[model samples]
Target: MMNYERLQSNINAYKKTGEILEAARFLIHQFNLDDENFAGFGFREELEKESILLTANGEIGEMQHVMIPKNIFDFDLTLVLNMLAHEMLHVRQKSPRMMILDKNEREWQAYYEMLFHTNFPQIPELSDYYKNFFGEKALIYYSRMGEGSELQLKYLEQKLEVEKFLQDIKNKTI
Candidate 1:
């Protein structure tokens, strides 16, 4: 299905740059993604939406392409890894009949998954970096879902669950 050689080659090409290779490797291992379904990934200056920081494309729940902002390399490695992790979560959601998750629901899941590793007690430095930096971003992003009625309530529930999970990590209960 997947051409491991080509994927490894492509990932290796980013070794001289920031931690892009490491970030990709971490997600690949974390998700246990198939080689073929992975489609492929790249950094490009040309993206369909100028406002889009990154993009992930897939068909029937399998990731086909991931186009990242070339300038993302200029940021902190943790942020870059976090962004990649978020997009990959979207790619992961596509298959198995494309479960109909709402936009905020999907965003909550992606942000939660992206920040899940921050709970690891073994990697305190990484945990701290993510908690200090990206953790607030997650809160801010999900906060937008707290607006109006029934649908918003469901979104808020998801946001609260993620908040509690992060809090548990902060308290070292997890």
Candidate 2:
């Protein structure tokens, strides 16, 4: 298991001046989420403690999400990008009255979007998009822990996806 201290250290050590910008570029080029400023991607110490389930709250970029930490505790650029992509999906999925009624479909689509960049072509106002669905107060919650969990498969899928996506991003950056 990866310790939090070591993982956090890894992120700090692999630091860059334009992590935010790079992330934005990544979303734009790879995910086709052409936003000039990735204002939605926020980071904090507390965030590392929350998974995507606890991170989302019917708010668009309002949630301070850990973004990339999985069970591995590694903080490489890939992990950071992976985390950002993961949270971006949540941000993309934000609806005011979001519900668990379609968790599987949402997650399935989210996973696919993260991997293949087949997401919404443009960024929309999260609040407005979900104002009627989940509202500002009604947060939809789901985890890979219940009867719906294909945890291992999802993990593998994300791992492969991140790896490939990161490589593609690397090719562009290089």
Candidate with the greatest TM-score versus the true structure: 1
Q: How many steric overlaps are in each model, in order?
A: 5, 10
Off by over 4 Å in 2: 1-39, 44-57, 60-74, 95-101, 120-174
Task: Report the lDDT tens digits of candidate 2 across residue range 8-86.
Answer: 4544543443354333344435535433223443333334443322133333433323232232223333433443454
TM-score of model 1 relative to the true fold? Answer: 0.54
Best candidate (score: lDDT)? 1
TM-score of each: 0.54, 0.34
lDDT of 1 by residue, 118-147 (tens): 322221133554654455666665666666
As for model 2, its CA RMSD to the true structure in angstroms is 14.3
lDDT of each: 0.56, 0.40
Superposed by TM-score, candidate 2 places the C-alpha of residue 73 at a distance from the truth, in angstroms, of 11
